[model samples]
Target: MTVKVFLATATVALGLMAVPAFAEEAPAPAVTPANAAAPPSAADLLFEQPQMRNAAPGSTITYDYLRRSGIAKGPFGAPLQDTVTLKVEKPTVAEKGGAGTPSADARDIAVTMFSGLNRVPAGPFEDMTGNPIVSLFFENHLRALAKVLEANPRYLKLAIRRGLRERAAVTPVKVKVGDREVDGWQVVTRPFAGDPMTERMRGLDDLTYTVVTSPAVPGEIVSMEAASRSKDGGELLQEKLNYDPKAG
Candidate 1:
């Protein structure tokens, strides 16, 4: 099945106004894979931010579910009409709590979604009330890549450094979405001599197939979509998050 991935934008609004920044105040910390640990689970990735917990009491958050149908080009890329539910809630402070702090409450506002491939009983298997679990596999792979890049800067051995140095330098790849380009790293495994040589015999490069994309930016995709000579089919999977200012 061949699945061509694309995104359409949607906006949801909460009544809260954006606060102006003060010049002297320190800048908001950069959210990088190195600083931010891999989310423990899919649920932890979605609504576990301080901002979500700090929404004013009584404010409601809205979600829009999208189901799209398109031609798939992969082993399992059958015509898929998938429905994804986005649950949005604005966290509010319960008045009964003795803490007088304005936003001390730690309630979570999240959007949970399940894919057609998911067969778990829905409760203890994976939390469906929190983050969308559809994208967990991609997140884990990207983080693993980042760890490799940071630890080993020289990824592939250049001809110049072959015998002179015993180390292989790892190169970092730039990840971009919209106008923001994330700079970090991941470790990809290269194939060794004992690996399958059929592709190599045909003059095709033989490389071990594992890549980690670190800092797992939202909207970044790690799927392959290309034309092949063989008629063999495959499965296609894609998920996207489109954000915009709340509708007027």
Candidate 2:
């Protein structure tokens, strides 16, 4: 089936967040896929950070989900709104006290979601609450992108991953947490800018994706967005997720 049709029928999960820690004091991890043994890259930090390490078992973090495409030649139809929650549970007895006991911060993480009419289940995302949900967010987006462009998902993922590791910008910013402001970092990346096949992407070659994270928040993610628009700004597709302060 075509990607559009598969998207309309198949159940896929997406997630994201934003916030930042001061870059001057501590930069995003520099480890990436190329060097699995090295420190994490910005991409690694964004998608693989130990976001829930500090949360006690039985705690939860929630996000507001949004997915929409413009009416003018947009790639998607209708808007999907939902609430996604990550629940942390205590590890089982064997995992807690035996020789195979996990690390001090180890905990069980699962997702509970309210997708309304969207009917998109958490799937792999269901068990991914330990790290930030942005991994699932971008994973689904990349899948959709590859399907829509009739490109290889593996290649597309690799390109984007490399772009995230090499071209992403990590900068300091401030975010509001309740009545106070906390330091955060805004990460931006344009993975397709250097793609040799840009012309075939139908204006998506310039798509921009951003992430914000902060150490002050319970979950480091503050917000995440992937968006693209036609040259004339008529057609567009935007997917984003933001931390809901009041709900958490």
Candidate 3:
């Protein structure tokens, strides 16, 4: 597939950037320059890491999914619980990514994000590269949240981009994978808190996003959650996804 088409898909998926990575325009690996920078931030690990490259080709990774949007005085309804899967299929043919190619993370791997007839947009992305699940999660989350709040998507996107880049906190942690505990990292950020347009959120302003990643996991991502509740803890809206070891 052409690099152009892959980038187009990325634009629709996350529509935001910290390191310009929804695995977009990923380039080939290069050496570290002498005048290097400090250690990577949570944003860099979460966004720029070649998460997909860690997956074994021909393997399948699964996640337990939950998306609930029920704010008593809001516009959403009940939650949907399902299982989401991503299969790491090898490149069956040559991909024209010599020059002008975006990020090469998983450039040789293709993924199938869903297992059934889901309403989420399906790309002609069969030939596209990068981590499809990451793109899918952001696309679905931002679009739905915007609709639920009746707020502009750009505003929300900006808040997230800014939060991750400037205020996100990253900490080392451990996660369970079967009977064993594995090292992992947690990245947490509250993009909507103290937002200038708080009132427009109708109480979703404290939305917090937490992501966990472990190298031991097939897809690198162990879990992700985006949630917010009302002041009195009455209304609630939460979206979460966790890796399913049994399904691996």
Candidate 4:
């Protein structure tokens, strides 16, 4: 199985200052930056992260939907149509202090349905001939993961932990942010050599993801994208990820 992961975060420079929030705040205590957490091992990282909520049970978040078309296929492949829709849901604010302490915290969120479509040429018989449809699903998954990680680093952590425990592969990467570089990681999730697909489908190859960090906030994530193709263009389905924060 082949897997890929990518993540990024938005980093606004001083020149592009955002309007400051009006909320009152206490000064943060000064402290040395502790040892940066090491990237998880390929195996551990993919299988150990926490579950990403499909939708937070009691919270609401906004959604951003992005769609594009006419994506180019790999060399020797037919041109394909593609679309992606993502949902970002269930954002909750928390207290900044300890995990359970009543300090000030804001915006806990989750993402789902990062799906896309890519068309593959059908056989003369008009049925899909290979694995393009299956590959598209995972491809969209990876793309969504990459984008969400860019906007939220903590989400990346949770995704990695959950993904690894599920038998995923991951790697750390360095990406550019405005004028700086940040450390990021990627993860791939899939079944072992002989896992079964649902009744209607045959076995699937693999599902992989790469998560990166945004350069500016380091804490914020920016973008994600993925691509997939089968040896023979069979039937490609374009999927998209749509993030809707308002869905609690």
Q: Tell me each candidate's TM-score.
A: 0.26, 0.74, 0.75, 0.34
Candidate 1 C-alpha RMSD relative to the actual structure: 18.3
Q: Model 3 over residues 8-106: C-alpha lDDT tens digits?
A: 211111111011101111111111212223435865666666676666766877777776654543344445666667766655444555444343444
| Descending-TM-score candidate ranking | 3, 2, 4, 1
Model 1 over residues 1-248: C-alpha lDDT tens digits? 00101101111000011112111211111223443333232112222323223233334322222211121222212222222223333223344363443344333334333355731222111111222322332332223222322212122122112211222222344544335656533333222223232222111112222222323432122111111111122111122222211311
TM-score of 3: 0.75
Per model, how many backbone clashes are there?
28, 20, 6, 62
Model 2, residue 86: C-alpha shift (Å): 0.7
lDDT of 4 by residue, 1-248 (tens): 11122221121000011121222221211112223466566442222222222222334322222332122231112322333222222222223333442212222322232234442232111111111212234344434433422323333334434444555544555544334455545444533133231221111122233333222221122223232222253222222222222233
Ranking by lDDT: 3, 2, 4, 1
**lDDT score, residue 29, model 1?**
16
Find the number of clashing residue pairs for candidate 2.
20
lDDT of 2 by residue, 35-108 (tens): 11333357555755666566677778777777665533334545566777877666564534555655555556
lDDT of each: 0.25, 0.60, 0.61, 0.29
Clashing pairs in 3: 25-102, 25-103, 26-102, 26-103, 26-104, 27-103
Superposition TM-score, candidate 2 onto the true structure: 0.74
CA displacement after TM-score superposition, residue 69 of candidate 2 (Å): 1.4
